[model samples]
Target: MEKFDNVVLNSRAKYGQFYTDPNVGRLLVSRIETAAPNSVIDLGAGLGSLSMAASKKWKSASIVSVELDNLSYFSSLKGNHFHIYADALDYDLPNKIKNEYGEFDVALCNPPYTRPLWKPEYEKILEEAGLSETRGVPKDGRAELLFLAQNLRLTKNGGELGVIVPSGIITGERSLDIRKKLLDNYCVGSVVDLPRGVFSNTEAKAHILFLKKSSPYKKNIKLYEVKKEGGV
Candidate 1:
């Protein structure tokens, strides 16, 4: 059997195989402080990698991790981890998210890198989808933008958000459009360029975002072009 079937749940068709390894997970958790989740939600939660790490680091934080694939929620890695098997776009976002966690203080995700798969799911939907379709729905679209918006809604004012997304979200021209949208609603507190090797086997580059929901921080936002520093 495949690794996910043996551990979590599997759909047979792979969306993408870039799971942030333990080391990188630690790095992300560390940067975000993973201090205490009044409640923490993870999108694209595969095998509980980041959720597991966050649990170990923030014993007091409530963590609600969600993954849509059949393989993840049913994985053997399911235990000791609170996994919600739901499509991110459709899931509810509450100010006080409760799970094994009594409440949540933060939310985050390592979203999907766009692939050819998106066209089929979206091209047809686009004809009828309204503002959400044009603007990109956090729970529905490629994990990055949707997750950002989702986090903003789920987080309390002044609460913290840390997510891993594509560096292009900040650098690419098209992605800059997404960046503009993010800036409109939330504050970009910090940016960590995940090293390329962190996603070596994969084709896309990633970035770590430390965001504050209410507004931008007073200090200059930190930026790093992490080329291969996130050890998977």
Candidate 2:
């Protein structure tokens, strides 16, 4: 049999995985205004770094981590979390989980960056979320956007979300539609731009998006920049 690390490396390549640094995960969790929640969900959870951080922070919260990569999912099994090995986008989150675990009070995600072709499922996802067809989200939207949309669907009204996304989604013209959709649906709590090389492996600059699901929309979004000291 192959070595454990070899299996993980292979899975990483197969899944386009980029595991979040523990420090980065902690930083993202720290952005949550409410430290204590009854239930939490971590989508595209890799190695359970963010999930672990959240468990520590929440103390009494039940965390469900959904991952697609087998090796990574297996690694998280030893942690204090409920692990689900499946594509979070397509996972059948049972109603029992929702009832027992409490309708997800918060969600944290560091979604994969892939350019998946648009599908009818994407439309179903949006329709389920009560979001109509909106401008800015292109037909050939990236997978990260799809993941974000799905996360929104999973989150309950008034729930909070902390996600790490590529900086382009905030600044790039191509992402304007999605951004518009996001601002329309969620109350923007804050956006923290991380320094380059934070990921160690990738050069892409990342932003931590802190948002809250709101009805009727809200104005004014907080923006911050994280420097070496980790302050906004």
Best by TM-score: 2
List model 1 lDDT by residue over 53-151, tens digit each: 777777766667877776774243333456677765443434234333543467767765533224333433322221134343333345455556555
Per-residue error at 34 for model 1, in Å?
Answer: 6.3
Question: Which runs of model 2 end up more than 4 angstroms from their true locations?
Answer: 1-12, 73-80, 91-102, 130-138, 216-218
Query: Which whole-number lDDT from 0 to 100 does residue 167 have in model 2?
Result: 81
N/CA/C clash count, model 1: 26
Give me the candidate number with maximum lDDT: 2
Each model's lDDT comes to 0.59, 0.73
Q: What value does the lDDT take at residue 84 in candidate 2? A: 75
Give candidate 1 regions above 4 Å deviation: 1-14, 73-80, 91-103, 115-141, 225-232
Clashes by residue pair, model 2 = 136-177, 137-177
> Which ten residues in a row are the worst by lDDT in model 1?
1-10
